[model samples]
Target chain A: MTTLSNTQELPNGPVAAALLAGGAGAAMLGLATTLAEASAGVKNLLVWFNPVGPLSGKTGVAVITFFASWIVMHLIFRGKNVNFARATAVALTLLFIGLMGTFPPFFELFVKE
Target chain B: MSISPREGWTVLHGMLFGAAFLLAFAGGFAGLYSLRPEWVTAEGIKERILRLKVGLWAMALIAWATVISGTYIVYPWYRASDATSARSILLADPATAAWHTFGMEWKEHVGWLAPIAATVVAFAVTYYGPALAKKVGERRALMIFFVAAFATASIAGMFGAFINKVAPIR
Candidate 1:
């Protein structure tokens, strides 16, 4: 059995990757939401499932972006050290964008009509 | 008395999955916050880490399940084009129109972020394991993600409850 040690050294890169990927995923959702509101073409394009309408494409793309970016970043950042602070800052900013973009008061501002 | 299939699914998505996610956050947050050398012995840390791993992952999965069910199953029914549909019913009255336009729209979109953030927190905690206690910066970042996940889910859940009350999926 592998005994876990409290003192073991671990690289912060993977955590950074996860953080950045999370932010990117969130940002993508925000961008998609706003774009969908702003353009009929974007809304129509995002109707991946007719029943769910644009939400299908919006969420599907966000999930895909999350996993895809996580994989890519994990590969790049694994076994390496990175600036955790910077990555977290970027992530928070992206998260804020996501929150604002989803808010009706905010996203409605971008409506094409 | 029994519920329709749509109501059953709505219950599962909101009450079972969403509520579970919310309830689990307190445990996960407490565990994460107290994971320190001074706060626990090595043995205690090990036990806590295991609990955190299980709890965090469960929360993440529940978050995903909630959003998936909401966006796919329940949402279609809510947004159906007929006048009797929830969205149409809400939109039919200027007084209740915001329930669909604002509440439903925000809930659906912001809800996706919860899973993404929760997954990140879970991955970070599992990847680092016991060593996370020593990584103050990393731990802080994970907590932020965890809290963000909770906040997003809470918004979605609250709106979901209200929307259902004002304009039920049934």
Candidate 2:
């Protein structure tokens, strides 16, 4: 019965803006790599997706974003009858796609081989 | 249900180990008695034989218990959904869909039942830790660690929606 928003605050004001900020960051990194390496088409595509950062990584900003999310989830899910933790985890994962999909620094290191 | 395919691996392993130990014990008795009949004596042989039989019975009981617990692990795979249910949930291609579900369910069962009971129980413990923490906080958490670990593997399998993953994203 516990929805993702239940007992929880909306993440960081506007979700859209935050997601874009993250996405753009990733895109730039991809473009940067392309520019530095001398490749064109692949560079552009990489740049395009780069802004999103690495969504499924261990130590990147991606992880930080999720860790923040986990903290928030734990607080909201503390005593509710429904499964707030799982719901929040799902919500966090979606939000992270944008946040993690971007950011080159996060991508270069955190993601696993 | 009571009778499920999840028990298959559990049954196999249990039977293997149980039979191995039983054989070893039997061989031990035979070797000792055959090597010495007078000094070892008939009374000694009788006592050894009884001990060996008790050991076999204990092994048999444990093996049976493995078969029982295995049902839950197997249930999700072979018993959870009938063919019709799986077909509807999966992709348009029935063959691919069936194979997909089979693999996914197999992965879940393997992740849950195989390791902990046979190899290491810790694997299940970590997987279920968070969910359990949410349910009961820190108090009885440790006790449920093993159960949580095992169940979490199954939960992950169910959550993975392996069929969907394999289906074309388009």
Candidate 3:
């Protein structure tokens, strides 16, 4: 019987890839918000980007992004070796950028003129 | 200007949507602690962990939904030109004006942290938890994640309630 150590067992390729994908997906949503604000065309297409409107549209976008990325990552990492640390670093960078992208809408909504 | 019916429903839905996710997370944590390695069958432990993992994703989804809805509701309420500011809106009614000073000022800022923290915790647990727990006793890692998640959820709830009370649907 082959006994695998916990370190070698946990967060296998699929899991690491899923995490990285989720982060990237969230970043895309954040970037979308910025794009919606910067371009009138995007704003019209993604009305949910409106700071004053109902958030269902934006929520829907985020949901799509999450699942889409998860699926893509699952496929890409399937039967492949993954470096969890490197994947995490890349994902965190995307998430951070996405987070920064979200600021404009928050600013427009909260701060008084 | 009064909130549109669409925005109102979004806020209402977001508030109600939180209950199920909260229950999932809290229950998952409780179950984790309740399991005794010596007593529970290995299969039983795996099932529990699987449920907990699902809870992590559900928690993240709920956090995002709630944040989006709450922001939609509160942003316009905050920016209503007639009101000038959140404090001013509350000041319009002295009876509830005290809330503005109590913590409403920081509520939005603090509220923003909930989704961020929840997402991070979800990803952390999903990806790194098992391996990390192996390094730092399993019980301690589980406890740490639970505490952080619970704190974020509590803050999310508190600020949601505070914002609704101070600003209201209008």
Candidate 4:
């Protein structure tokens, strides 16, 4: 067994940062999916295509939204310098999406469901 | 005997819930280890991080599947089941409805908290961890995020199990 030194400091490198990013992205995808399904409007819109019929359509939208949002998020942040403001913007955007789905008014006015 | 739609949904819900827990265990280890690379002296830290990245991705996907499946199981499948609705139960028998609605109404929303917390932590860890490492130190920030991720996964898993028990399709 490898004995760990309690005093040993965390190594400074890009690897840790990248791993953290990747992990975070994965977790966010899961959350985004739940948010998407919570918004009935999003479901009705996605289900219009009827990819897998009524039963799995919500799951389909969620899976699609998660991947699509991940791609978009990476595209926005890729190769660019990310700071506090930009990070906050991304988090707020996610939060806004989630909160919007929870709002009845948004769905009542715009979403058919 | 052939399985009813409700029974099938119950099985699917249980399977996905179990898968999420399994994935979370693997991913949680990798995530926590990633925060403190010094713990893994056996292999190259960077290499471990790359190989283990799949754990988090898989965990995320499974978590998504579990949430959506649970939602579908609870709303559509339960609605179609012969069992009485939670609303009706509340009106008829307040004591009995208390048990049912806790899972359907309360736990359903509570289950979302895991994902919400995960999302916020993910953005911060990815974007801000590096930036803030200069001031507060990288290890501290990462530990916070890693622990948060694990906590959320555990919460989601617990919620999954609880909902399945309280609101199983009859």
Give the TM-score, chain B only, in order for the candidates.
0.99, 0.29, 0.71, 0.62
Q: Distance (Å) between predicted and true CA of B103, model 4?
A: 3.6
Measured against the true structure, the TM-scores of the candidates, in listed sequence, are 0.97, 0.21, 0.55, 0.52
Who wins the TM-score comparison?
A: 1
Worst 10 residues of 3 chain A by lDDT: A1-10
Model 3 CAPRI rating:
incorrect
Alpha-carbon deviation at B105 in model 2, angstroms: 16
Candidate 1: the clashing residue pairs are none
Ranking by TM-score: 1, 3, 4, 2
- Give the Å shift of residue B97 in candidate 1: 0.5
| Candidate 4 or 2, higher TM-score | 4
How many clashing residue pairs, candidate 3? 0
**Best-to-worst lDDT order:** 1, 3, 4, 2
Off by over 4 Å in 2: A1-113, B1-40, B72-79, B82-170
**Residue-by-residue lDDT tens digits, candidate 2, B1-170:** 35334334534433453334333434433432242333444455445445544543443344334333333332234332444433344644766665444454333222322122211112212223222112232112222222322343343334334443443111
Query: For residues A1-113, what per-residue lDDT tens digits would candidate 3 score against the true structure?
Result: 21113234553456555556556655665666556556656556765545554233444566577667777887888667676567656766765654555554342343332
Q: Judged by DockQ cut-offs, is candidate 2 incorrect, acceptable, medium or high?
A: incorrect
Candidate 4 Cα outliers beyond 4 Å, as residue runs:
A1-70, A84-113, B1-5, B15-19, B34-37, B80-91, B100-102, B110-160, B163-167
Better of 3 and 4 by lDDT: 3
Runs of candidate 1 with Cα error greater than 4 angstroms are A1-6
